[model samples]
Target: MHDEIARLARHVAPRRATRVASAGELAQPVLVVGSTLPVGQLEVIFRRPEVGSVAVQDDAAPTRTGIVTRAGLAAALTGRLGYGRAVLERRPTGAVADWSPLVVEQGTALADVAALAMARTAERRYDDVLVSGPAAWGAASTADVMRAVVAELAERSTHDPLTLLPGRSATWYALRHRCSLVRGGATRVVLVLLDVRDMSRLNAEHGQDAGDAVLAELAARIGAALPAGCEVGRVEGDGFAVLATLPAMDDIQAAASADALRQHVLAHLAAPSDGFDPAAWPALHSAAAWSVAGAADADELVAQAERRLRRERRAAVLV
Candidate 1:
């Protein structure tokens, strides 16, 4: 089992980094100028393409002293005698300069960035966050922060954090799609729910860490055994669900396909691992239900499978 998992991991492609750090790579140039620059100079800088806000740096200060936005500059310049006047002379130092801007280090996590950005938005502040570090110095705009946040959320919604397989929502969507294909008279779709027996007992006897390791190993084994075009997801703790589209065939052929998948998973999971007694190898029990595309929705099909699963469990207990 360990060898099989290692082989699968080697063949699996590396996952892309989903942090806010990647968003920095997409950062664009921001406007920055010296505090001594005149109002006319600042006006010209604002006119430049894609320049939104300018960071004002004082010669005596190591960091940015303030920010001058295009709107603030226009307001400050109203009724001014000449464009050559110093910005400070027209609007005063504090009047035109925003003292607060979102600032972050280079390696800030994407999720953290998203949280900060959302807080700022809630307060009706739309200023860009400044990112500073080695090889990174730029402003992350509200758009950039929101984009990263949305991407991170979408990923989290669809994938299980521990197993990295599709979560409940994604699994339901996959089953719905497969059912649609079946309804189009293309092929048969089968939904199979598998439960790991005694998983909770194992966790209680050992620890959560051991249980997590077991779950991860089980996920890998199931993924490796699934046929191409089959979708598998971690539906709940100690339980997995598979949506498979069988070849154009009758009920017997479709049932055969589901049985084959169940056998493959059970066989692989029965293998022993280090530190685990061979007699304690995890046992799996599965129940499958067939569906035609237009006959039932995803929820209905899942309910049918669950009923079958309950019946089987009851029969086992009775025996």
Candidate 2:
């Protein structure tokens, strides 16, 4: 009995020592990754502000994780996932002594980030853990998690989350597999990628939630603007990758569809929303479209579209 009591006391003493050593490191912007600890002590150790963000793992079959901050945790539960807010927490005071504080860069959307955090939590079996990232623009969020899931689905089907147009993988695969059929005649492939401007600011200022809303809205508008017999899926975050063949690939016809797609997107953004405030709209947002013919396959075509979009973003920055 005496030996056990002394051993326990000795174990606890080291934890206190580690905490003391961690004080300076904890003062900076940070992510607190650990499984077990009370929120109150966590706040004190990390000095997180009142109304800060946090998540607690949810106890679902997959294991839903939770952030510990009052506002962030509650917001996530209420479906208002916040993004770009720095995370802070304490290192555990006892063994398994491999645990350390965590910190990561901010992501693009709150919705995406919350989704990722939940994903990580769901994947983890242990209860004594927290996952965190930066609270800056382009940081991860629940919506990002959704986008990732959606993208994965797009790989299987025809949908793309970015532009709500046919994704590169699905589109190219379909073109290669179906375009060669004699019933369809010799196919001409026309691929287009629409590039948007300064999207990072949108995620940073309006918050990831707002940014995701814009992406979703943009994708829907693009999907609706396609020409007859055309299919759309989102392939990337700020670009729409498209593939069509032969007669439809004519310069005039393809240009018209691309123009119509761009105009529709602009009109939608200009249109009033019931809940969106125009006064706080993002400062910069523009679109560019790319077209290509005779692609070997979907993967190659998508790579081409990605290159086009990257070039447009760079040009926009210069402009």
Candidate 3:
């Protein structure tokens, strides 16, 4: 007895793992068994409460396997079949399993699984989606899949159409989300607004296609050249916003960081990749204005930045 106790303590026993995969994030262990089990026995098996569904391997039509849900089994025996347990009690459990349950491979995308689940007939529309693996089976709830799909759609909506950068709504949302965290330090928020010199005239002089290429190229320059952690967004036509949260502790450091970022963006605009010829595109130039704020005053910060940009444009005209 002592030897058995010591050996058991030394070697940890294995336990069933609850695993989550890309196919469905919320995964649950599903009991998989052969078809010969009595239908009435499932009532006792399901009483433990952890098992949401069961995969019964059998020679059922439409698919070789089926999922028997607790609710499904109950309804099948007591409601669907006329004689209730009297008729189904002696039958194999496979006879009552959902033969047309949606089956997906282990790595299938959540959105696709959700779509497939909803596409099923009304009778089986909310059935558990079975994740088939090389050696095991798993299941996911239809509600979880739908929630994932909704989140994916919400995020996709925030992308700008042309540059594919975060659009105005996303930019505002990020600023608001991070506002509280950046309480008061040196000016921690850097908002740079850039617009082409003469967007309308440029399009007229060249073509709409050239204007688009310029915006896309400009977005690439800022998105690629900025230091990591900075968020770049194309908030409006011919205008881009770069929101940066700096670690500067003083005005001097904040000023230095902002100027450095401005220079970095301008330098990248002048320079192109080795394979690309700059002469192929129009001499891409933009007017830029910057605003730095230490508080969570996004509105005031943006207004000051726009005012500065206007003054700079007027100065350029005078020159």
Candidate 4:
């Protein structure tokens, strides 16, 4: 995961940095200037002691003519002024469709940025202040870069290259988040830790490419098979973490559903084209599911699941 993130960061860092430089040019200088009168100077006037916004205009631009905040101005300047435009044009950022936030695109509108800020603020408790002007708006470029960097750094710091899934950091964060969510009235959360059996042997048998193919196959299969409202992330090169809240059912219904899901997954893995070889795949499996509605969170659940898996691995004498 570290390697994959580093590779992606290398690809995105240049573009992100350029955007940052552009935003800095617009907002930093304005914060240095203060609200005065200019058709195009856009400055932040003090509305509050520590909080303020900016306004700027692009009269000679090739497009629309109007006043906008420092935040909106970043997009405006990029659209009109042309300093950090290239970077924002190149990389846009947002959420993961089925999994995680992957990229940031340029055409993402000011309205969209504002909406995102609002959503993040509501969900994660953050302030969303819009600043106007080239300088104030320019600062948004830096914000984008920082967000990209955090996502990129998180990937680099905690993900496996072969599978492109969460590594240790992601797993830890997921566990922690699930625990928090559980405390907030979540009913049922399942903790699953999966270890590929005889992975090293397969790698040795088929060579590195074959090993990579196996890992990739597992990654793809799990991703495809993840249940609704469940988030499955890679925990290590050879292991995965699954956090999910299964709906409550009667004893028979619950057992049948769990069994069916397990069977379906096993069947999927057993198929030749599905990716992994059933013949050499690991046999020992450990599963533990518990209700979190009665508990504080998923921390203990995660610990129990990990402990169970470790015991199974030991019993199998897996090295």
Candidate 5:
């Protein structure tokens, strides 16, 4: 059983919440100035604490723009006095601006922003992401962009790759959520664990493709067999689970429901489909359990169900 269930069950919001679907959500209003702004004047503007970054519009090409951070401006002006403060400070801001800025549309997703930001050369990798919008230009700092990336990755970690199902962390979280619902709601939640006994043997006898196809096919079949208010996720490579709420049932009724569902799943898998061959398949076992009005936490219920699935009554050992 996964030890991280308790940790995952707590819903900890990301620094930048997972809801940040686009770069626009991370944007901060920035100062926009004409390209012709004097370098010395730009430096003076940086002195004002309100200005985090400045967007410079190209005078020759109005639609084209560049960005300058206070640090970037300092880097430009701190050079040994070549032309003197008098001559050099007056050069157009564009000369010192990052002409190749990481510009993104306001609607661009944070994942895309992170990709563009990281793909940049090391010098520009930490540059702010410029948001080009209809009304105004905004900036998303590289740090914030990275935070958004972190949140995005965290959200993804809870999901399975091939089945696109909520993975281990997410499964535990949902289990808790459903347990709460069942306590006050008009139903009871049951967890069903199905193990494919021949997974490793299938892979060795056929190939990885066949093994994968079987898991995917079983997931689909189990999902289709379940009632309207149920969810199925891939917890282990060869194991799939279903969390379903049925009309209040006694322990006897619950076990019967579980058996009926299990048999339906096995019957479906016994036949060959586009995903696998019947000849390559072998014994399958399943165990089902539920809490009485949320008496058990998700981890305990899952551990209980997994323990039952270990012997032949459920299926051959996971190998």
Candidate 6:
């Protein structure tokens, strides 16, 4: 079992891995011009859609003498504040300017970037970080770092660790929300429950690795077969559910559409991947039940679907 688990770990998709954003990926464009250029040009530079900040180049030096931001430009426009005054009062001091950006190499981990961003935020400085790579510099803002962190956390919480599908909680929430919409007379919903027959027996005979492979493959096939707006989720061990919003139609049409979707999923699951032995592949059974907007609550719809699924599974076993 340990060997099988280790093999499954290596073979399963790495959907849970945290993604790192490179400095180059996060950088925005900066306006670079001579420091002596007219203050009027600052307005023009700020007007450019791509310019987020301006770098003033010294005539004699290879690097910028000061950086100008939109806020500095606004301050300059309101009064007779000259470029030199803006540089002295608004821009970072030479020492601070040198350290403000906190340059890092490309492909730095997002957590490291977030740490740097948090440090800067603590100091009340919102300067963009410069990412150095073989080609050019890229910029990363504190907001960007925070957004990545939030997205990573959300994915980990809402997705199944194994199948990478929506987990039970998210699935329940989606179904509940859809049921609410149906109750409002806005739409009809169909809930289809699918079960894998003899899944435990298959694991006992072929090992857990095969069982994992089957579940993963089943997830992929169901995702592919689902209609554009339908939601598929891993609701339990060896069980899956789909929440689909049916078009405005009579009960007969809605049932037909739901059955068609169920058959589509069953067809895909029946065709085992080339890697699996056909004789060892698990059988899939599905049952679908639909409710009009006002017919049932989310839990009731789920219960109805499960009852149908059990009936189908029993019939399949008896046959």
Model 6: clashing residue pairs?
27-138, 27-139, 182-293, 183-293
Alpha-carbon local distance difference test for all models:
0.68, 0.42, 0.68, 0.47, 0.74, 0.68
Sliding window of 10 residues with minimal summed lDDT for model 1: 4-13
lDDT of 1 by residue, 146-244 (tens): 777777777787899999888988888878876665575636667889987778788887777878888887788787876555667999888899776
Tens digit of per-residue lDDT, candidate 4, span 153-176: 555666677787667677667666
lDDT of 6: 0.68
Number of the top TM-score candidate: 6
lDDT of 2 by residue, 62-105 (tens): 13333444433333234324431222223321211122212233
| Arranged by TM-score, best first | 6, 3, 1, 5, 4, 2
**Local distance difference test, candidate 4:** 0.47
- Per-candidate TM equals 0.62, 0.39, 0.64, 0.48, 0.54, 0.75
Q: What is residue 232's positional error in candidate 6, in angstroms?
A: 0.7
- As a TM-score, model 1 comes out at 0.62
Candidate 6: Cα lDDT at 231: 77
Pairs with steric clashes in candidate 5: 285-314
Worst 10 residues of 2 by lDDT: 8-17
Residue 107, model 6: Cα distance from true site in angstroms: 2.7
Candidate 6's residue-wise lDDT over 1-319, tens digit each?
2221112111112234455455556666555566556665556667776666655556557554455556545654565655554443433223123223466677777667778767765543565566665654456666776777777678879988789898999998988877666675635777889978889899999899888988888898888876556778999998999877765667776677777777777877877788888877888878988886456488888888988888887898798
lDDT of 5: 0.74
- lDDT per residue, candidate 3, 123-199, as tens digits? 78888889887777889888777776776666568777678788998787765555545656443666667666678
Best by lDDT: 5
User: What lDDT score is found at residue 87 in candidate 1?
Assistant: 37
Task: Return the lDDT, model 2, position 91.
Answer: 30
Q: Which lDDT value does model 2 have at 276?
A: 67
